[model samples]
Target: MPPVPTDATTSTLANSPAASLATSQGSRLAQRLQDLGPLLGLILLCIAGWVLNPDFATAANVLNVLTRTAFIGIIAVGMTFVIIAGGIDLSVGSMAALIAGAMILLMNAIGTAIESAYLVVTLGIVFALLLGALFGLAHGLLITKGRIEPFIVTLGTLGIFRAYLTYFANGGAITLDNAVSDVYSPVYYGSLLGLPIPIWVFLLTALIGGLVLNRTRYGRYVQAIGSNEQVARYAAVEVDRIKMLTYVVLGICVGIATVLYVPRLGSASPTTGLLWELEAIASVIVGGTALKGGEGRISGTVIGAILLSVISNILNLTSIISVYLNAAVQGIVIIIVAFLQRSRR
Candidate 1:
């Protein structure tokens, strides 16, 4: 090459690193934007709803739509932790139904449909939580000590819990009769400064969940275990304890949600909480949390819940088709979300 002019060579040398740095920074920013696809999808869906139907964008409609998602969102929070820790919990849905049914029956036994019942409701909550913890314990022990797959263990509990709830209902609906109704109605329907009670419940869950997952040593152990159990064990982590603690935490979330959910529908049926575990998983995946573990995105999961509710809300508000097709729409959205996740990975 011919010798360059002094000023030309100086300018070239000064610009080269600047150009390379800009390219590197641009790539990083692009990756961040790409990682935000789910959030973008949620916003796009909301905007689409707004464009298609005026009412879908209203405050009343948004609040009404979101309150119902609180239950699933709460459960999904736990599912986020479980899946990130490299485990799964299928019995959450059935457990919700079972716990809700059991709680109603407990109140009913304490008094029929027409007596004062504060103590009963209090005890009912305590009992339901205990039952949830027990179920979690059973699942954790079986998987950790018995060496069975998490899938099979939770699946077995899923059927068992569903059957137990069905049997408790005796093939009929279990309603919160008048007496209990007065006592428990506010649990779900009550508002705090113009917001639904469950919304606050979910916010608290997110706050606590975030703290536990980010600030604690257990959180690091969990990520390590999920990323590689063998390596975690070799590093002297208490793999079993962390895993069991995670399941117990999941059970606690389910119990808390049940306490809120029962008063909303005011009854329990076999179909209560049907397919909710799938929804929870979908929300977790949509949040960009890794299914295989070692990574987590609680914020993404919350957004995922909002996105799903927004989709169904639009479908309902616009009266797009037969009510039966609602599942079809949700199913399709879930598949799309899943494919997006896999492709990103």
Candidate 2:
């Protein structure tokens, strides 16, 4: 047998610069793997989809998956900011429903007075965006000024929003006028360069969101707040304002999505945006954003949204599992990702 090493030798080796460098390198490699995990999983999922159903690879089907992903994908981009700043907004779905209903009502009511369908649609779009911003502002104020938890504030607004929409619709659907809808349908159905408008819009939103998150001082402030609010305050980061603005961004995203969605179905009802919160949050988490906040990527969120949409599309195309189980799959995915995040921590 070889001679046993003494404590001095072992301790010297452990304390050496080479050992420290190796440890640091190992940590970086592990972090790199974690960052790429979601993208790799997305690619594997796509391959599995194609293997299960050749149609999954078709251009038409691909566009359809992306088009469907636009709404939640846009919302998930906003959610990336909120989550990175350590905030949550459960009211987005209900808020969308209210905005949709109000927009349709505004367009229809204005159409009766204004002869220009184009003008009516423009006003409605503006109304949707403004309402979204205002709603987001309210959430921010409530959380920051009123000193309430983000979860509790959003949960309360979620119920209030949906209830008001239901009351406005009288427990029925709020259908857009045919004339206004005809002019508006292109927002959802129209294509440019053979790609759906919604998809293009989704890409633009993701691009802007990525820039804001990674490039700006505001982005750094948001991350700092999420990492440690008290520390960030001590650093003069204006934690409350940044946190509030995050909600406003999320609200604006919801509004943009609603504007696109109205033309597709031409109606909003109690069930208009059911379970959207689940999908948005799931997309953010699935994209590799930490549930505890302070860490996330916009690119990861886009990939996560597409990945979830692909899973749903595959389920719809294949009989291996019922499409009804799609939500179940998403829930399970969130749980698995959350567990993985915890393990990493």
Candidate 3:
């Protein structure tokens, strides 16, 4: 009618609007399923727990597990950032112990001079945060500027940090000042409405972490670096700066965790955070983050953290499973998840 449509025009019309919409819908559906995988796995795990023990569904038990999960969950948030940026931190466990021991020592050293328990605690908090950030910065510099492998650098630092803790405590526990402990105990054991305070801390950490990774330009750089460092460098992204900052973020997360942890036990020993680095790394991987880097989801990480905690809780609740086998169980789960991911690829 309109001067006779050409063959190309007909073909364009055939593929326009409706076809495009259908394709877009299909893509979104695929993405939705991908995002739903971890959550679905978590639900299945919870169901299995209920089947294994009726008490697994109890509110008290559930809350207890969530509260305990907060510690590893917080650290894993930082681990997510580091891993997504194509790096790893093998020293978090030792770093946590170092921070805790150093903080307790600092507080006790000043406890006699400062009558204000609040002031002493505040100073301890500041010191812990600063130390964590500084240590992170140092690690970043060595990795970025000094051109060292993250694994090697963090491993060296891990031993150094744990040794410092041992020396600080003199092979014993560094207990917090009793007066300060009395004032700070509520921070960990206290409740906000019906939920534990630790849960609130975990929620806050996760929220900020998600925003940073999803909504910030820095996050884009992180993903870019991990995906292909050469491509990112060609695009004028500051690869070194972004990678270093990721470690800083990790350190701050560790600091926040130490703050919450100190209030619970009111002490720090060489073994305070022993073997925690593995748990944090495992949590990140279980959340569907690629071990090779370049992609991750924060919400999935929180779910993964919860899933691990639930398994540990279940194992504890069941006498049939030896408590010593907890680590073995975790290793098996990690292996299974890795195999599934490989198969999916």
Candidate 4:
């Protein structure tokens, strides 16, 4: 047996180092493709849709899908902060729903019931931002001072906000009254210079986020903290403040998303923004932002959210059976994208 083993070992002398390297190089190429699986999947899907529908590539269709994506895209931008900080915010969907609901409620309660649609909606938007910030503040304090895990804290708030919204509408839809509806329609429907208002908002938000995350010292600290909070603190970083700021940023994003959201439906339901957190997370991960934190991809996240919206819009426009099944398809896409993202590392 030992003699036979010696011959087997001697076989290495028969192999060329060049061939061995070629094999290793082949393996690495395969790994790279695996890493790029999600991006490839997206490209493939786009090609397939283009082939399937002549209208799929039209400016109208593209614009429509992009407009819808802005809501989640904006929220995901804020989510980038929380995730990059090595925390999660499950309450985002509930938070958006709550804000949308409260905004509509406040518009109704506004003094003298202002007839100007934009003014009422403007008031709602401001109110939503402030309220969402309050919620974020609460979340930040609980997580920082109480020393609780962010997942647990956000999960608790997730349930609380969802339940409150349910209680808000008495388990039904909350339609904007006709008077308010007339005033609110233009906020979502109206456009500036032929572009949808939401589109402009998303572009601006992305630009601002890009500047903050990629061009500032605070961004460096965020990545450092996410990479290793212990090391960050030891380096004299303001860990608590950074963490709190992330939450607030996320809250403000949710508020912005809510402003666009309510005008679309002009009402609030417990279902408003349902599962949006999942979309936000998917957008961040798919966009190339790290799940465990440390790095972020703002542009990638923006495109990711658009891809999601496109998938949904195409499904709705096509002759797909059982509209309810659309969600299952979305879940599948998300799982596939997430799997690809994780596999890359």
Candidate 5:
């Protein structure tokens, strides 16, 4: 018989190069699985959807689902940057409502001064983008300059934004001018190469967002800051500025999504964009982004957004559960994903 191994021999084996290599390989494999998790989930969900309702696979149904997804998908792209940079913004839904209300009011007011519906629409779009940037800048300044926590800041603004919109509307809906609505409807309803304009916009936004996150210096800085803010600063990164820009990017995305959304409903109310913050945040986490920040991918976010939309579509098509419980499902997804993140850690 071979000599019984001693404690020292066992310890030596554990510390050997082969053991290290094995550990490294295991880690890499786990990481790849985590990265593919969202995509795989999406495929499985689609299969289930098809099985539940053969109508789910039709071209019209698929396009309709995607068109509906554009608003949240666009916003989720920006949320990806914010989460990767170790920040959160709960005010996005309320911000969109306020922006939509303001856009309608502005367009209505301007229609009287300008006979050109196109010119009025152009002004409304510009106003929406500028206002979004301004709001984002305010959030950044308060967080960076005022040295406040992002959660607290955005939470306060969430209430404030919605309250302002409510007050402006006098607790009612703000409807778009009919003529302007007709002109702007195409932004949401029109199709290009057999795809909805909103879908096209979503694709373009994702493409640009992916490029910015993967191929640019700013993206690296955002990741470094999220990984370790103090270490990033020590490494000569402008941590505050990068963090600020991430919020600005998110705000711009909110603006773009709102521009697309307003035309669909032709109105903004207290109910407008309800629980969108939940959906947006859920999408980012589901896409494999770390809740604690430091690591993420835009592609994952895009898939996550699509996956959530698909889930909602499936539910609607199959009545697997009440349509009213859609938000509940998303909340559950966030909780599950968060738990998984903690377990992985």
Candidate 6:
């Protein structure tokens, strides 16, 4: 978190008639172009994939790409809020693993303890979401009330969560109970109205996120808080409260992603959600949200997530680069997009 200026500093800046404007001049055309950045990137990636390998554009491959996109895409939605509100969460990936592992362990115990209970799976899902929210709340409180930097706070929690997961899994995999596996598998692989469930979940999350960010007073507060903390304080915005809620929202999103994630693998491994924070951040940045905060486009974030999946999918289908090089490509792409975003500003 940046330093919150004092009243004197605020008054000094305000009274300076010669103070130069540092903010973007409101321009609808420029804002539209910025909003289109991720979509344009997605289009270019698709075109490249098609030109490189015709199979990349096939329906089956596209569906596969979307399936892969669902996990990170969902997480990125929450990340948009955190970043737009001027915060970061490094613990999300580890937090997801921790939440998923706990939920699985609970469900398995429930299955063994109560053979007749079919609601265990549902209970586990709720439990995971609740756990995620709690984790977020903890992070939020420590950062807001404690006045700790988000990067430092979330980084510490990231390691703590990862360590707990490792201990919970005994440094191995935590498999879902056989009895519950059959019952829970459909949540990940099953489809509704000819669409995979994860896709539907991502779409719903993005829709709600978009509405909250674009249409609500809370959303405006978020932007204000992120753009300029001092100004936000002067305007009577509850900076800490809004910032704390962003993390809570992020936690819920991670929990939802993990719920869908667990059924697909039928197990929780320590490796699950590794480095997901970096990917989610990349998606949000590519989506046109400034690293300095105060702006976001939910639709662009979704497109950015899909763009990442497409890039990976394309790399997997070709020999142009080794599989190990995929991460390198992603890093380079993120850097390039960041530069583009900076140039636009």
Clashes of each: 1, 0, 0, 1, 0, 0
Compare candidates 1 and 3 on lDDT and give the better one.
3
State the displacement of the C-alpha of residue 109, model 4, in Å, after optimal TM-score superposition: 0.7
Could you tell me the lDDT of residue 220 within candidate 6?
66
Candidate 4 ranges beyond 4 A from true positions: 1-40, 111-118, 319-332, 335-345
Q: lDDT by residue for model 5 over 111-219, one digit each (tens)? A: 9899999999999999998888888889998999899999999999999999999999999999998999999999999999999999999999999998887667687
- Model 4 lDDT tens row, 1-345: 122222122223223232233245556676455446567667766776787686888888887887889889999999998898788898899999988888877887772467686677678789999988888888888888888999999999999988888897899977676777777777788899988999999999988987787666676667667767776787777999989888988999999988888889888998888899998998888877778886666777887787788777767667655787888987787777766655334
Per-candidate TM vs. native? 0.87, 0.90, 0.89, 0.84, 0.89, 0.90
Error of 1 at 311 (Å): 1.3
**lDDT of all predictions:** 0.80, 0.85, 0.84, 0.79, 0.85, 0.82
Residue-wise C-alpha lDDT for candidate 1, range 67-127, written one tens digit per residue? 8889889888888888988999998999999999998888788766435577777877888
lDDT computed for candidate 2: 0.85
Model 6 TM-score, 2 decimals: 0.90
The TM-score measured for candidate 5 stands at: 0.89
- Residue 182, candidate 5: C-alpha displacement in angstroms: 0.6
Cα lDDT over the full model 3: 0.84
How many angstroms is residue 288 displaced in model 1 relative to the true structure, after the best TM-score fit? 0.6
| Top-scoring candidate (lDDT) | 2
Candidate 3 displacement at residue 343 in angstroms: 7.6
Pairs with backbone N, CA or C atoms under 3 Å apart (clashes), candidate 1: 287-300
lDDT of 3 by residue, 126-208 (tens): 99999889989999999999999999999999999999999989999999978999988887999999999999999999999
Off by over 4 Å in 1: 1-31, 112-116, 320-325, 338-344
Model 3 regions more than 4 Å off:
1-31, 322-325, 337-344
Residue 71 in candidate 1, Cα distance off native in Å: 0.7
Kindly give the stretch of ten consecutive residues in candidate 5 with the minimal lDDT sum: 10-19
Model 4 weakest 10-residue run by lDDT: 1-10
Task: Name model 6 segments beyond 4 Å from true.
Answer: 1-27, 343-345
Query: Can you write out model 6's per-residue Cα lDDT over 67-161, one digit (the tens) per residue?
Result: 77888999999999999888999988999999989999999888887765468888999999999999999999999999999999999999999
